[model samples]
Target: MMDQPATSRTIDTQCVVAGSGPGGLMLGLLLARAGVDVTVVEKHADFLRDFRGDTVHPSTLDIIDQLGLLEELLKVPHTQAPRLHAEIGGRDVTIADFSRLPTKCRFIAFMPQWDFLDFLAREARKLPNFHIVMSAEVTDLIEDGGRIAGLVARTPDGSVEIRAPLVVGADGRNSVVRAKAGLEVESFGAPSDVLWMKLSHQPDDPPYTMGHGGPRQGFVMVDRGDYWQCGYVVRKGSFAEVKEKGIEAFREAVAAVSPLPADRVGEIRSWDEVHLLSIRIDRLKSWWRPGLLCIGDAAHAMSPIGGFGVNLAIQDAVAAANILSVPLREDRLADRYLAAVEKRRAFPTKATQKLQLMMQSSSKKRQESATKRSGPPSFVRGIARWPFLAHLTGRLVGLGIRSEKVNMAALKAR
Candidate 1:
């Protein structure tokens, strides 16, 4: 039955989770493991998209360990980072260090997001009650008597109505579920946008990862084994000016801050190869309405700083499963149960976003200042000066402000 495509006119499940992302799939997996019937719907046929967040922080690693899947997850090929490095005004400095985190794996595992998604799908499929419908785009919410009763998704064959008492919107930043649910978003503007492209790594390149930021420009280099996943930052809404400057100038800008050989920038032959991510920092005024709930990026969108987006989303999933699994299993799920998730996760979400906003604003100010040869930013230099500061930042980035642990009850449910 799992092999069959979603062609039925109506499907029933205890919980309907939209989007097959880290948050959605994790929530679906946890709920299913808790003996609840769960369905996760993905708009895409496969998780092969590039430039997605791939950083698996220690918080998530600890959660996997609690689930007893840490050994299995480590088998997948990935690069581990115990400490974060950055170049501030041409001077190298160590920033966050995850080595001291109180987790089974103290380092971040950088794996391609597609592989991670595939792994979750495989594990979830092992459960008899879990189902994932791919290429099924959610078109609208099925609202009944002022409460969300289910969702309507358009599949390859046709449309199908998934009925459930609770609908979990784990979709991404531009969430159709939240939009259809009439949730209001409070948008905090971003100062810059990012252009992501890949460049081949030379044998002689530095052995470790480093982030580069200069006057009015910033760059990032992630070691993707054979190549480097590079990101070039430009002032918000400046990509048009970048294009007008010609691809050669764009290549030069990338070469300016990065330690990689200038010749490697030529690999980015055209603008089409580059992906632009317009950074957004915002959260919904309310994460749930009646029978519907929004978690992950659907509830709040975080900045790319510290690679916290995916980790925070997974935190939401862990907390959701912990708070709602029991009530859901008892057929007593209520709006208060959904609201509890938001209440529990709201602090970490707000605190993380605040930190990102502060850093982004500070960076913008430094870039706009007349000081040309500034060393590391004051905070970063402080981190470099005080080793404990690095540990503190590491804990914040790796473990988050409030990390959720997997509930034993949920794990033992059968």
Candidate 2:
């Protein structure tokens, strides 16, 4: 809703963020903190519904701590996912141990995505510069002279046109802003589909475990407190077939792979509790236009293997905010904002895509070999066994792997 009288002022110096998910809302919060007039438009009216992608990784925990949100986040009902145990070659190996991480808060927090988003939204509302327009859908981007300047939205009452100096596309994989900007996304690898369902917490539930079946390549992350998020490997477009087989068959498949008891699986009944996500890694050659920039799932969509979507989205928000803080205060800041955002996000996007490919490899032999390993792979285990190797491996996989260096470099550059 418009805060001021329509006759008194025009909608100038606006920031149109298309999605009000974690990425968009976080961006809104950061921009609003920087004294930017931000308007976040979300299609959803409330944040009570269930959604996929719940695991908050350790890297994001560090950022949350830096933002002074770590304590508040811990106050929420969440399970500390300390260990990432995977069944490789029928042998369990702990790949990521949060307790060993350097950060004070080391564990990956297992909380519903909606809860996290709701927390962020509550914090963002405390800032006067932030305005959230829920139940409003962005129909299209308003372009002026080959540059993105604003967006046209269909609100509850009527059409609202918000003209801004910069438009950030934080919408999910299917981004309206990306389409309007005519950005070309370079498709990297094959699509990996996941059929995910959650089960109710039972008294007899097994100990917290993370399971990965070799042949099926399915994974299950059991929360420490209650509920289990189960994901199955399926064909790229076979969600309907899996659903057609009925919930009983699905439960059997999950029980056979996961460490949890079969009876616990019976708690799931409705299709509403289950969701199918088609995952892919897409990188745009350019993440900027004349007056707009894309971040999070809008610019790069990585495979969901490492549970990195939400973390990467938040990281992207940090980068974009840091880059735009200075430029956004100027009269013509769109160009510099876009360039800086792209520079900050480029390496991270590429590194994440590479990791996605490593996880998505469908080679049965590789899966079997990985599953057969007694502990973390020889290369990884060798390091864990020795203090030096452990530190080295930790540095390589935990921090040095992928885009951490690049992200840190970007932050330093800013």
Candidate 3:
């Protein structure tokens, strides 16, 4: 036969999660572990992307412990950040001390986002009821009787239709599920965008540094064992201007604020190496409808401040599993059960976004003010002065406003 027509398939599950990000994968695992039939659809073939959020906070580590995957996760190559550091106002200061957190691992583990995703996928694959369909982009939501019933996904091979009682739009900020479902989003605009690139890490480099920015520039470089995952912040809608200035000029700007020597900055030899993350902070006006719910960035897009985005997304998955598992398994997934997930997560989401906005505002004001003083804001300076404040910052950054625990009831339901 010279050619043959591609085939189509239909899958039926109790819940279908779109997107294989932290939120989607974690939710699939939790639901499957609870004896709920679940499927996670991902548009990508592999989780090999660079410069995604890599900080796994203590809160997430505790959740992993609850799932009995902590030892395995810790076995992966990572850097432990018990104390977060930053260069503020030309002074290196310890910002958050995770050493005091009340968790099994009182530190933020700096692991590549790919490794983390792969770990979750691997663990989820071990579950009999957990199904992951990679390279399947969810194109549209399937509706019946005025409620979302399933979704249509397009794969390279053919078309795949997944039928489920609940559709989770964990597909991230530009979620097709949420868009198709006609959910309203309230945007809290971001002040800047980030240019992400990698620089070779030298043996003599600082062990663990977080941010390096001044009045004219903003940069964050996290130690990634052999390399530095760098993010250069530019004013919103300014990447074009940066490109017009040429790559050399951009490299100079990076060098100006980089803790690395000038030679290391040259690694960014071309514009292709720089990835621009157009930051957006927004949340859905409502996180759910009758038979569908949205979690993680699908519900609230978070700024990269504090590297809280990944942790918060995973938290949403945990909360979703806790609140909706039984309801979904028992065929009682009413609107209230979906709404309960939102109610459970809304406070921490709002509080985290508010804190990020406040920090962004403070940075913007400091950059615009005509004051001679050129250090971090007064509160940050106070944090440096008081050791206990670092602990407080650690709790806020590591544990979040309200960290979630895996509901044992959901786990035991299997």
Candidate 4:
């Protein structure tokens, strides 16, 4: 029980998880399956938001099959593409081929992120111990002797306090929980920011469902079936420059690189339709303090280079659940356990960030010397030439450096 004075303002549970994104929801769901009393608080009222991380990579699909949620989750609306393609020098080049990935599903499922989250949320709610509080935004950390014990949040009803043995910060990039806890983040600055928008896709449009990337000139288009989810990567802090060029010029630029008709770009209409994401490639140097631990986007903010951001977040959640659930249930959450979770995940996080930094460095080079810049670099084309190497690329993209397996062995099913 909480040592705080008896007050109705406080709600106690075994674990209090913040944020309802992929990582947050996944951690909560797995923890609940491990028979832990967990409460997930989300500031958003619903999961029906336009999310850019729509590619559910093969590794994540493998995890779903493990939980026996694959059949049911696949019942939701989604599209699948076996191979990821990119347009290089006007040639359709295969980047990461998922067709040969040895898994239950050898394709990336392109579903609305909301549908993915809702499916997980519905499954989570089936457990009596799992409770979700929506429209609840965490305002500050609840500390005792410099140790984080819980959090203070503003709910629709009133400001309430949640006290738990462990308080997990799974909030996004600008995590209030991470900030309030005084954790430090190290930055590996991104070379570009993403301008996300949607335009109606026509039957005559390019049939490449994996999307296209043209050096630094074109926008990446994913086939979301009805409306194409398009994102233009502008040199960091270049949105205003793009905006000042006039919408017509911007439309022409998009059409020059993408397969979309010039008139289709006009559907974007004005600058207001363009959503600017100040891309950040950073991660917390330290992920915890005492009774608090962080996972997912809270600990590391990834660049959307390979659509591995969401997959990485989900992997963090899986690793966290594997390590923390048992300790949390038995009331043995120590600083070392938190450190172990960090240690287990640190390698994958850094390795992925290292790859992203290399991409950013190359992008900066392309920006400085336009003459030297062309279609995708030589290595990207080299993989497509060799059939065997393309499959290896699929293995890396589909599975990642270290694929985490779920271990819920210590608790009884509720």
TM-score leader = 1
Query: TM-score for each prediction?
Result: 0.97, 0.85, 0.96, 0.95
Candidate 3 ranges beyond 4 A from true positions: 1-8, 370-373, 377-379
Instruction: Please list the C-alpha lDDT of all candidates, in the order they appear.
Output: 0.88, 0.69, 0.87, 0.82
> Over the stretch 286-356, how does candidate 2's per-residue lDDT look in tens digits?
98889888888888886665566777787788778777755664544858667877886788677767766
lDDT of 2 at 376: 28
TM-score quality measure for candidate 4: 0.95
Models sorted by TM-score, best on top: 1, 3, 4, 2
Q: lDDT winner among the candidates?
A: 1
Which ten contiguous residues of candidate 1 have the minimum total lDDT?
A: 370-379
Q: Model 3, range 334-364, lDDT digits (tens) per residue? A: 8888888899999999999998888888767
Q: What does the lDDT come to for candidate 1?
A: 0.88
> Which pairs of residues have clashing backbones in candidate 2?
88-371, 88-372, 89-370, 89-371, 89-372, 90-371, 383-390
Clashing residue pairs in candidate 1 (N, C-alpha, C atoms within 3 angstroms): none
Give per-candidate clash totals.
Answer: 0, 7, 0, 0
Q: Which stretches of candidate 1 lie over 4 Å from their true place?
A: 1-4, 370-377
lDDT of 2: 0.69
lDDT comparing candidate 4 with the true structure? 0.82
| lDDT score at residue 360, model 3, on the 0-100 scale | 80
